[model samples]
Target: MRALIAVATAATLAVASPLLAATLGDDGLHKTDWMRDTFKDLREDLAEANAEGKRLVIFFEQRGCVYCTKMHEEVFPEPVLSDYIEENYFVVQMNLHGDTEVTDLDGEALSEKAAARKWGILFTPTILFLPEEVPEGQSVSQAAVSVMPGAFALGTTLDMFTWVNEKRYELDGDEDFQRYHARMIQERDNGKTD
Candidate 1:
C-alpha cells in the first residue's frame, strides 16, 4: 500500500509540475509548447497563423533578461493567461542580439538583431501583435496592430492579449488599450473574468 501511494503521488506531481515551472531553453529564453519553431519568415508565419485560426505574434527577447524571467515565472504560468495565449496566438520568438536570418513581410531579409533594430525595439520581451490581413508593401513592424513593451502584471498582460485577439483595435470607438484594460480590470473584479 505504501509503494502504491508513492507511485500515485509521483504521477500527480509529474502532471502538476509544469504548471508550477516554466522551462528555459539553451538560448536562455522561456520554452513553451505554444511557441513555434519556424524559419523566421514573417510572411510564412502569418499565413500559417491565419490557417490555424490564430493571430501572429512576434516576441523579442534577449539573454539574461530579468523581466523575461519574471514573465515566464510569474505571469505566463497562470493557467488562464497561458491557456488564452495558447489558443489565440501563434508565437514566434526572436533573439534580440542573435544572427538568425529573418524575412520580413515586405521581403526585407535581415538578421534577427537587425530586424529588431529596424523595428525600433529597445527592450526585452517586446511582443508584436499583427493583423490578419497586412497591407502590401509594409513591413511586419509597420503592419503590427499593437506592440506590448516590457513585462506587465498578470491582469494587464492578459488584457492586452485578449484585446488583440478579439480585434478590438478595429472597433469604432475611442476606447484604446488603456481604457479597455481598465474596463477589463473592473469587469474581472466584478466576477466577470473571461
Candidate 2:
C-alpha cells in the first residue's frame, strides 16, 4: 500500500507540475529569471534599466495575493508575454507589506510598505512603468508614465506593455492606452497583429 501510494503521488505531482512552475522566492514573492534582484533603490534601478535599453517597471505585490498568483502562474509564463517583458522591461518586485528598505526616486529611504503607501499604491499586482528620463526630485508615482492598477488578461497586459514600450502615451490626441488597446484587439482579431 505504501509503495502504491508513493507511485500515485509521483504521478499526481507530474500532472500538476505546471501549476507549481511559478517558484516562490525566500521573500515569498513569485520569482522569475528575468526579475532583477536589486538593492531596491529607485534611482539606481532606473539608471540600470536605462543602461540596458529597457524600461523600468515596478511590480507591487503581497503574499497570498490571488491576482498576483494568477499573473505569475497563468499569464507571465506565456512565452509571448514573458519574452516581451524580459526583453523590453527591467522588472523590480516590491512587496506591499514587506519591511525591506527601498530608496525612492526622490532619495527618500523607507521600507517597502512605506514606499508603497507613499506612492499611493492601493492594489496588489500594480505595475508602474517609468520613463527613461525622470526629472530630478520626482517620486515614483509622479514619474510613472503608466500605472496598471489591477489584474488583466494576457492581451490587455501585453497591450499595456507594448503601448508603454512604443511610447504611445506621448502621442498627441486620441492614442492613449484605451484607444491603443482597442486598436490592438482589432488588429489581433483581423490577424494583423500577434
Superposing all C-alpha atoms, what RMSD in Å does each candidate have to the true structure?
Answer: 2.4, 4.8
| Candidate 1 structure, TM-score to reference | 0.92
Global lDDT of model 1: 0.91
- lDDT (10s digit) by residue, model 2, range 4-81: 999999999987766434689887899988898999998999999999999999999999899999999888988888
lDDT per residue, candidate 1, 73-121, as tens digits? 8888898998999999999999999899999999999999999999999
- Model 2, stretches more than 4 Å misplaced? 1-20, 191-194
TM-score for each model: 0.92, 0.87
Q: Give the alpha-carbon lDDT of every model.
A: 0.91, 0.91
